[model samples]
Target: MNKKTLLFTALLVFGILQSGYTPPEEGMFPLSELHKLDLKKAGLKIDQKEIYNPNGTSLVDALVNVGGCTGSFISNEGLIITNHHCAFSAVQLASTPENDYLNKGLVAKSKEEEIEAKGLTCRITDSYEDVSNRVLGAVAQITDPSSRLQLINNTMKNIVNEAEQKDPTIKAEVSEMFIGKTYVLFRYKTILDVRLVYVPNRQIGEFGGETDNWVWPRHTGDFSFMRAYVSKDGKPTKYSKDNVPYTPKKFLKVNANGTDEEDFVFILGYPGRTFRHRPSEFITYQQKFVLPYTSELYDFQNQTMENAGKKDKRIEIKLATRIKRNANVMKNYRGKLQGLRGIDLIGQKKQEDAALAEFINNNVAEKAKYGNLMKDIDELYKVINGDANRDLWLSQIYNSTSLLAVSRNINNFKTALDAQPAAQKQGFFDQNINQVKQALSNSYSSFELDVDKTILKRMLNDAAAFSPQQKVNAVNKITSKGSNSAALIDQFIKHTFELSKLKNQDYVLNILLKNPKSISAYQDALLQLEQDLNKQIAALKPEKDRREGLLNKLMGDYVNVKEKFLKKDFIPDANSTLRLTYGYVRGYWPADATYMKPYTTIKGIIEKGATGNPDFGYPETIKTLWNAKDFGPFAKKDLNDVPVSFLYNMDTTGGNSGSPIMNANGELIGVNFDRAYGATINDYAWNESYSRSIGVDIRYVLWVATKIDKADFLIKEIGIKL
Candidate 1:
């Protein structure tokens, strides 16, 4: 076998082993089968009889179409509430370094004081009508892939255009699922005027630090506040001092006294994405190869950046956020790998594959069309396994640095364009020149350069034996001190500048002037590196196809494997639209010797405090709360001395963040923040036996707001009714 083929085989073997399955048992879900029970039936819940729906709100009312985690009004006036992290970028952009709003947090003292964020918008008004027949009628008989894709896109575009024309204020988007089996056209009324309302300091918001990202038994006050603004006439408008505070028809009231175990809860937000429908082989590939490689890349970046951060305080501050973000993702991927191992995912997948194969055998036409597609997918896995390591190295090094190359290339394009036709030249300059400048202006600084170089060197060294091209280029560029570096960069800048000038566009000039060749080089290098990596990936296709076919055959053979053994129960994710997952609030043991209890109190913060770590340090106010024998009604146990943390088995994911975890009677208990370690893989497949949701008691938010921040007015506005 070639090196790529060998690598593919090795990854397949590793995946099977990591998933805790023997060869024959690979790809089998011993616990349950597909289609035996309805996921909607298992997961959905509605409060139709109630005056208001507690399980979920309308997608329109919640403003689900808005940018990450923003909401809108059911009433004529707009009012929005979203997570703090979701609004961080807008906050950062609006605040100066001197102000550092993120550090101190921000609260609009009144409607007049609220700051309008630039380019900030919240959209609503999606209208979905079934046009399945209209879309598929013409192409129902077409078998060509390109034709099908084009047909789908054309249909979607037409729908979106029609929707946009009906309401000029509305933005439209089209989503396709099940390989065009379903299409949804979403129309949204854009609310461009938004203002900051309230935010808690990083200390309170991200309490657990790197130690408690995805794990439950948790305490993190991950919440933020924002309100919508409208024109004087009460219609959505651009930022203006004249705009009035929007009054929402219905907004969730703050329930100070939180709920206990088995209470119903729900969340509404724009969840980014999930890979629930990915093929079993793809899942296995990610578990064994992709995730591990990516984790290693993050670790390398973290260490390199952290080391640099220590030298310069500013660097430290800048990289601190990046490190934290990367660390969170790294922790998630690690937990995901562990979850895959613990669940024997490969074994279950194999069983499902067998059943699928048997089904295909029974259906001749289905077998002929889908059989090759399955084979191709398996080949894709093998290719992925073969290229995993190179892909990681390139991603960390060349891919990350490709911006530099792109800048250079853009400059070259400008130079070449001078001789081209006027119309084409004007178009090119108008479009490309401005973008180049923006990229350069935002390029990583010199402090970051050292860190990037360190990672690049490490990655190049790893690939030295396998691929000499990168190492050769690195040596030629750095050691030889090639004059072409600066000259080429200058040429790139000049070309872009000239292009911008020719186009007579200020925006074009701004972009070209800001982005230098170094940044462009980084971007170009990434593309080339990816191309090389793909060559390696392409080599493992044949063997991969065979393995995939085998797995499919196995699934078909054991079609009813899961239904025959495991109990018929499964739930879908908490879509912002509506969902209900009923389970008792209980403590869970993640590992053999590690037990995560049901709740964490304020005292736990004091106990876990490290004076040196700003993230973990207790504020003076919290210390006072501890010093005083002031255990309020919400305090549990005689352990005012003991800090509290809670864990419960409730289904939740990204959208569930900031959801109200309520009691059986629908009283607010806690704010959902994250999932326990065992549940991180719930994104892939939920295991009711172990997966749990972690939430911060609503009482904590009250305590922080009243005692720490002393924001009495804001607290009162939340309708605390205390």
Candidate 2:
């Protein structure tokens, strides 16, 4: 069949299914809604109270939001388990040539041996309450979009303030769900003294590396362990030698028996974002323009880092975390773009939207409320399509330049200094001095002049690619002279870096500390360039804000109307909110004649090892142990070998990495790290047939900790279960 025929067939099948279609039990549903689902029918073996309880500690209490990734307590002593990639930044921060944790790995044999994870923090949800009535009441009278937004913000701030005043140690925020249809207040206990406990070498943790990322039948370990410490008084406190290991009220029990296909499973984590309910125009704009544009920018970044890393190991160490992050995003976007086409997402979304439009038009009151919503939203996208591209390019350019970012930090301090009262000027200057010092310290620690030069040059050239109507004059002027050629841009970068005060440590320090007055104090070539770019953004801010306000108002109205019209408990889009998604342990058929098993065993690792790529290669000791057929008790009896990774039909996204995948009885079964390439489309549309979350099996984690690393203490600490 031709492409169009296949799409038409698929659409027909989908429409037929829709008549009786149960919303796939595949959603990141809020905890409160768990009671609404028939747990027995859906294969759940545990009660909703076991997972979440506002009055008492439950499974949710064991989960931690770790550096934008999810983690869970595995021991009462606060041993936390998360993905290696999730802890990548902390590992990278603690790494150096003489004692590179990334290369050699870490094993804190005792509590005293554990090193602090600087600038890392974890929070456990203390409570989540519905506050929709209160929030809506506060903004009921507001009509103007800006005023409405301001009132909502103020109300949320007041709510948060009251909650915080009750317990200074807790952090609270009010988040809107279903757009503005619902509001929830989440309170969390912030733990600051996180410590590195264990991390495997990259050869093991990041076994498949970028090549095998988001692919199926993976061998990547992708797991790490850390510990949270509290003050001697047993309260969350900053890193200090006086701190003791935190004792979490609850923790997950490891189930070493592993799971079979169709076994009930669930995931609890903060899913970053999902556009499943977004309009077709939004999806089309992203597929056609945004993804391709950002993908190219990421490609440039990856190549530059690779080129620079080959010459300097320090560069390799410094850029390892960034390169991995960029590559993941690039590949995800590419996969999503392809998946959207493969499923004819735009076509499907348009059909659904058209049907909904018809439904709205058929009713008089509904017509008055939502008749023009889709049309208005489509027009909004058209108005800002080119601007979106330009904004993304500008953002990439600003972020890629280390010196520019540093300069902006200094400018922020200057702004703060000027904003303070005259009597409080000295106190303000003193308070900000430490911040400036830390900022400079952090900037230089990972900053490589040569790498930044390469990025700056490439960014300028790419920025020039923006159409004349969308182009910024500063970028255009620089590129027009060189015709956006690499060599000319290179020369410009070299000259600018050499002449800029930002190049010298003493000059940067002098400007940042000597005069806490204005950004004008820094008469640097790089600063001038930054100022020019800032001017362009400043000039566009008013129009941008106006457009954004209109879009938000329209979207909010659309969501409110749709939720009532549908008469279903429609969950809001994921916005880094804690959520739970459940499914069965299952594999999928990605194509016509191929069916993949739910799990991959140690034997597959040996088979892939023959490829000889560093990503596929295993550590020598691990290989020897596997070769000897040394299957420990952690090995699955059915498989007769340890399961390395497994797949399940659970919904997940970026921030879901490191989430603990639990079995029906709430035992820790795996650590979610990636989704299959075809499943990338789940962010937009979930297809149960293809969508699956891949996780490193808990048995593999145990085997590695006991047999390979011989982390006997950790194994004993967690205690075994089957």
Using lDDT as the measure, which candidate wins?
2
**Residue 567 deviation, candidate 2, in Å?**
4.3
Clashes by residue pair, model 2:
178-572
The estimated TM-scores of all candidates read: 0.73, 0.93
What local lDDT does model 2 show for residue 41? 52
lDDT for model 2: 0.82
- In the range 606-644, model 2's lDDT, one tens digit per residue, is 888888877887777887888898878877776788999
**Per-residue lDDT tens digits of candidate 1, residues 558-601?**
22232332343222222333233334456655667775656677
> In lDDT terms, how accurate is model 1?
0.55
**How much is the lDDT of residue 284 in candidate 2?**
90
Off by over 4 Å in 2: 1-25, 418-424, 477-491, 505-507, 510-520, 564-567
